[model samples]
Target: GFPGNYTDHTIANAAALLGAGRVVGVHRKAELPNYKVFDEKRYFHPGSRPTVVTVKGFRVGVLICEDIWVPEPVRSARAAGAELLVVINASPYECGKQREREAIARARVTDVGLPMAYVNTVSGQDELVFDGNSFAMDATGEVCMRAPPFVEGLYRVDFVRERGRVVPRSGPVAAELSDEASVYGALVLGVRDYVTKHGFPGVVMGLSGGIDSALTLAIAVDALGPERVHAVMMPSRYTSQMSLDDAADEARQLGVKYSVLSIEDVHRDPRDAGRGVRGAPGGYHGREHPVALPDAAADGLVQQDRTDAADHRQQERDGGRLATLYGDMAGGFAPIKDCSKLLVYRLAAYRNGLGAVIPQRVIDRAPSAELRADQKDSDALPPYEVLDPILAAFIEEDLSVEEIAARGFDRATVGRVLDLVKRNEYKRRQAPPGVRVSRRAFGRDWRYPITNGYRRESR
Candidate 1:
């Protein structure tokens, strides 16, 4: 466990306090994964052997997270006379990830014909949110026990020897969560842990009267109570009266401390020459003036727009001109940065179902930044219905322009979207961290170089 040039080893072991602490047995992880947010091979040396330890006259096999993904480790353990298997994990949460985990566990158990116990950690670590849906399976690949997702608690599973074979007894099994519930739960847990673990007293975010910010505010209050959340509405000349009403209504319904700090005066003042108070290109002064207050005054400032990865793709396509650096993108954490615009609406509707915190008008209103007069998202980019699918094909599925266009999309649109994604790596590099709820996210999931000359043709 030295912190020098040698290397680090990840292991699972059983310990006994014989006078002091005695290491009875150890199982070093044999698989070093290096794909999609995992870079264990960069820092770890893989062990080549399987480990089984005896406890209370029962022989148990020990495995780490990645060790269960492959078959060699489990096969070796069975050959070594292991009666049961226990695998410890810290698997990150993604949509339908629990089903995938159980399927994999079932495959391994059926292969070895032995019961297994799987334990996963629960907590938010940076962008990764680990859902602790730990489980125990019988020899026939049936789940005997399952802990609830997004909850932290100790669970029990009992195994008894029957017909000279170890089998897990039937126990309570938690039901699976729907896609929206699971993603929303991940966002709430991610925000709560990021704030509390970093010792922030509270969170302050801009309330723009848009669905994204409304969803973020609801999540903030749910994570840290209404008392710890502060919502500020900084309206500009271009901001609509409907937006003002919706923002105030959202704050009032949530019972959070709210304020209205208009930036029209600051935008018009001529004496403030040295404070970088100049209008940006396109005559949009909205983004610059409003972010200054929360950036300096709040304990933690969260950017709501960056929650939609599809929006980020469009922002990149605008040559990073739409959102000001350190202005709209300034924040400590972005709860839904991995979500798409379509997913944002789905989550908004989902949150509203569980008590109706966000106003109905907010959900029904057309999406906009309201920076310029009469601005709509479709004015700058394709409709989210069209854009999100293209972005997903390129970012998550790694499909080519031709492949995406073959799916009844405009070839030119697919090409343009892919080009924008390629061009905007620098902007995404500077955006704040957020919960990862997809198979691929912006931060560690997508790692395109800033200066690259690769291009794919739509034709």
Candidate 2:
């Protein structure tokens, strides 16, 4: 097999040693991808052409990641007398990315009349995670063999000459991952590899009693064993006793090193500070809110409001002057920042399903910031049942206000939500990067202009 190279030196040498003919797709010069989630333009040049060769009395073609997605490369190989296509990919895992790959491959196979085998790299790489849902399809555009997602292993397949053409024998087809499962797996792998690859001894995170911190802690403990993870709870005067108890219970159940630090001395009520510190228009204090938590129905909105009223106290004191790395907000990374209010709850429940690490009460309790007394998320925003879907439509689906309102929401509400999403772009831009699990995340996928004046025309 030939790989993309700068010159034919390596390929020629290897072919001479093996005494076999080979085709190589190599960069004549350094090239780079000048688009989303890729900085390749900073690295290597583009290759010459699709590699086609003869192997085991069969003509075969080899293409790289970007090559297979387009039509010309596969067509070129077919013109060169290739009967089979082998595409090597390092495609990153985004929501529904695997489907896109298969669709592209199917189109190629359909056009070229050659059986295609698409192999992708698996495991996590920093902010990106790769899903190895490798598979092969026949010239008729049907999958012949499929490998499981997110796992790494070798799969064997037999090809036989039938009717003067090489045909792939049908084999095992692993079930595609469910939406929640796939996202969760991606997050776990992303955390694990990011921590390990950087050669960190362990990870430390603030385990506030809230859903975002709770889910983050669970992911951390799952990625790196409890021994390698540390959870700390910092309570202020506004912190509720329930939050304290729940935070403590979470640390105990997960079996991680836990510590409680009181920030009451330095904590000031924003109202008292009198700096007009308004609550940021988001869920649970600018943190990822939960999606469909298990006991979400059990703890009704009535309970949520009641609990919020009980927990509400004061605005979170602005920490611009006091922010420090070693203070209340000390951590190398923030895992759940991108999660929505409802998704955070859902992930916590999902993690608990594998084991009872997060206490049931934590999942069942109403979410609060605990930065001030009786401060419920609902105080500043609509209920998550209303907010999450709206956020999804705007942030992920790119729907207009009228379109969102047509989906049974108030026009004013939709308008307000969209405004918040736009106004908060600066905040999101400054926030630390988190795992991307949606079609359009706040990270690389989104590149909106901060000062744009384009308004959604009402229908």
Candidate 3:
């Protein structure tokens, strides 16, 4: 199949290399999904017929990823005398997608009254992370065998003919992971595969004394080891002593190569230059000035640096007047680019639970960019406790200002946040790719145009 004529086909091959009549079964996916990072309908032609083959005197039905999502294909296979169903998938990871997959598989199994064996691909590709939680379910909708998430291995499930039906024998079932654990695992796997597959020897990143950078450093070290990760603290005149101390402590605790390169010499004080610049007020010169130092440091080491920007901040300031075009927004990859500020703290806490790598003060202190005097995140935007939920409602749930206000938020604040998200489209267009753990991310999932005229009026 070519680009526009692709088919998700499953082929059976014989063990012997020179075996005659090797190809026994072939099945093409009947359903083509076109939602949330999936665009199969744009490239694949939907298959219509069911393909069933015999194996060890039991009739086996073959299906692709989306086939079992609907009832037509599974019902057709059952009508065609299939006693067992085998599904091959490349399902990507979302916070609760494993349970969703099992629920859908159980529906198909119940409809056909046939046991199912599901196999999903594992690895990270670009912004997508495929968690390999392959599983098997009996006809009664009980999971018989399960594979752990974020791992690659082969497991066996025995099946026996019982009273004219193929019953899958119960096997080991790995327990489901908590939301934080699952998301952290996805981020770790995503960073590891992205760096290794792209053939980069290692990664370098800025280490601010903030939760976002601390979490990013921990993720980088976990993914590529401390030897391969380089953490640099580029402090400015406004950088606090607490920030410097915390940054150094993080690197020392993680056992990574650390450096502190002061940008104060090259960075002219806005007040000293007498440029008529007032006090630094969350503007580009104040906030993004230090961003360039870390980027430049990565160039010296011949490694790409990761940015610590999260989705909430990016949406609020990136394309607006506050963000410098290439200063803070510049980086090769952003591990938490899709995460909100609230989620960033959650992940940091989760990582520290394993073994306290990130300093407790880093997580406990107020969030700040440390780029300007007495700077704090709340100085620019709404409090994260209030802002993250509004962003999630608008960006992920596509709710209008009124709908969000109905959820007990101030209408004016909701309107303001939504406006910033819409206004920052141009800046987000230039952001680096990051692991997507939500139902929608900035890059491929959210596709609002850069030049749009539509605006929601606040009532």
Candidate 1 local lDDT, 1-459, one digit each (tens): 112122343432221212125655666777878999998777767777778888766789888878889899899989998999988888999999999998899899999999999999899999999999999999889999999999999888989999999999888999999999999999899988988887777787778888878888988989889987878787877789999999999999999888887766765452254334354433334344544433433323333312211112222222223454455566678786778878888888899899998888888888887766798767767887998898888888999888999999999877877777776677778877888898987888787888846655544
Q: What TM-score should be assigned to candidate 3?
A: 0.90
- Residues 1-459 of candidate 2 have per-residue lDDT tens digits of 233333433321011112145433321211234566776555555655545666677777766667766687778878988899877667888777877888988899989888988888887764578888999899898898999887889998777789998889999988777666777788787778777777766765666686667777777777788887666566656667888888898899889888775544433332234333355523232222111121122123314322110010000101011111222222344455456667767776777778877777777877665434576766667777888788888777878898899999999877776776666565454445556676666767678766767755342
Q: Give the winner by lDDT.
A: 3
Stronger candidate by lDDT (1 vs 3): 3
* lDDT computed for candidate 3: 0.78
Residue runs of model 3 more than 4 Å from their true location after superposition: 1-21, 269-287, 303-324, 454-459
Error of 3 at 217 (Å): 0.8
The per-model lDDT (C-alpha) reads 0.77, 0.64, 0.78
CA deviation > 4 Å runs, candidate 2: 1-48, 268-330, 451-459
RMSD of candidate 1 to the truth, in angstroms, is 4.8
- Write candidate 3's Cα lDDT for 103-145 as tens digits: 9999999987999999998999988999999999999999999
Task: Please report, as a residue range, the 10-residue window in candidate 1 with the lowest summed lDDT.
Answer: 305-314
Ranked by lDDT, the better of candidates 2 and 3 is 3
